[model samples]
Target: MADIAHTVHVALGDRAYDILIGDSLLDDAGAILAERFPGRRYGIITDDNVARAQLPRLLKSLDAAGLGHTEIVLPAGEATKSWAYLGQAVEGILAARLERGDLVIALGGGVIGDLAGFAAAIARRGMDFVQMPTSLLAQVDSSVGGKTGINSPHGKNLIGAFHQPRLVLADLSTLDTLDARQFASGYAEVVKYGLIDDEDFFFWLEEHQAEIFAGGPARGEAIARCCAHKARVVIEDEKELGVRALLNLGHTFGHALEKDTGYSDRLLHGEGVAIGMVLAHGFSARLGLAPSQDSGRIAQHLKKSGLPTTLADIPGKLGSTETLMAAIAQDKKVSRGALTFILTRGIGQAFIEKNVDGAAVAEFLNEMRALPLSP
Candidate 1:
């Protein structure tokens, strides 16, 4: 409470919830939940990495509040966001006797949030859950919208439901534990909000990225801004019927890359996004949809922040052009078997395009493989 925090309201009328951002909120998690869902016991779902660094503190807080709780710690990594572990989480919740009125707290990164939220969705038809996002990517994006699910062997987040959380507690202090790579990966998403539509925010980030990296107050401001943007978009288009689809600017390309890498630590979600965004802008430029300078600047910023901006930067073989194209073809955004992409006119000016020429995309990918990615 003391550290200058902010709350962004996701206006969903009866389903409305506030995204609380700050430090010490984790210690106050139980009280917050008690206020929101009185007399509800909690089932905490987390990954091992988060449990080691963050779970102890959260458990201590819940105990201090005298609230009863149980937790299931899954092996950490993107691999955990699958059907096998979804079953494990559901079984753990049932084992803890979590009823429909009970609460499930997702206390990890995006993977845990998606998996746990999906578990709550199918458990007894539906149940309320809270989001305690620890990673930068989760706090800024995945934890906000009700987009919960696991990766499909065919594509990322191909299997999931639209189940919103009752609340989202994004404790900025939790980010302090993230390694440099994780932090930068999250920043990629932060930059995404700007690239989606906010020209001013993108420029602001260009100037203040160092401060954000240093975990200065600007970091909180940046997170709040990103959350506000997401809340606004979700409010306008709860489903991906229209404007909300703009949010997936880099996801189509990113998902293909993720599938190629087997969704391993070899390429974190945000890292794939970093490269995808560069490719997105690069492709947009190649097709005369956007300016190359805009693409170059974004690539340079991502590179300066220590994220990969090219397929060459990713480790291991990414397979043939057709292999990657097949992955994109399976993207959920595809309609009538035609590819859909979120392209851009420039930074902060992204838009959706249906039935994108598949051959043109393949050519762009082929050219990207050979050209220097610096610009």
Candidate 2:
């Protein structure tokens, strides 16, 4: 086995798995899979971007181990996480003749992970799958949790299932190919773990943001810590019933913005979350629940990391407040037509608030829309 830098075990009893974070995990994947899943065939699901950049390393490893597998490469982007692509992934698995015991490997960023995992979940009445997350965002967040799904016309991730992976291999080397914007986008999620409840981690990030960005020791450490934190949450609330909602601290606003942007290159997922997190903090402050300065601090950190921290940072015209409110209403966090949000008391102090007034949210959004665009 190549030296693994970090390993976080997700303890879910029968559904338990480990998230392995290190370099060359993809190169060793075939040997790893052969030992763990002997006599099982494999279907590899990935995106065109990942396939071009990293698939050969994986295929070479698999071939060396004499493992049998088929590859399905989809178009790369948020829009690829749709019903049409979901169908393509599922049909590809079926056409590959991968049986129930065979595993589906989600070998890309968040979009491929969700699409392939969802495909594995229903392909043969729930076949097991592995997460081979290539992007920094996927390595830290989406690849750890069992929540896998495609986007809906109604909202983001509205149609999906909580199908845990058999294992997660987060190869650090894969991130080397990412552009500055993509890497910065992923960093937004890294900041989120600290924002959720680890004030110390956030402070540490502030101290070492440059090191992390420059791909030093802090980068691996940050990814491992985020994975470990998420593993604990998934173990505690596998289906997002309670504390798991805290993970969506900025996602409500983020998803709405994504829908508004039509899930295109106009705004990346991490970019939306960066802006959403600021909005979440700003909204909390508006309610007199948190210190106003906290939002500004977060915005400063995100902006330094090359992320957009305000609505004005988004290019082009935004939807009306009513349009945004409509998207928020369709959020999965809603309960019986009542709004629910993850609000904060301050840095590292977040809590879920149910039965939030829609009018209050609408009013805050109206005020936000009136602010001058960020220069």
Q: Candidate 2: list runs displaced more than 4 Å.
A: none
Global lDDT scores for all candidate models: 0.90, 0.93
TM-score of 1: 0.98
TM-score of each prediction: 0.98, 0.99
- lDDT per residue as tens, model 2, 20-79: 988889999998899899988889999999999999999999999999999999999988
User: What RMSD, rounded to one decimal, does every model reach?
Assistant: 1.2, 0.9
Candidate 2's error at 239, in angstroms?
0.6
Worst lDDT run of 10 residues, candidate 2, spans 366-375
| Count of steric clashes across candidates, in order | 0, 0
For model 1, the superposed segments whose C-alpha errors exceed 4 Å read 1-4, 372-375
- Which number leads on lDDT? 2
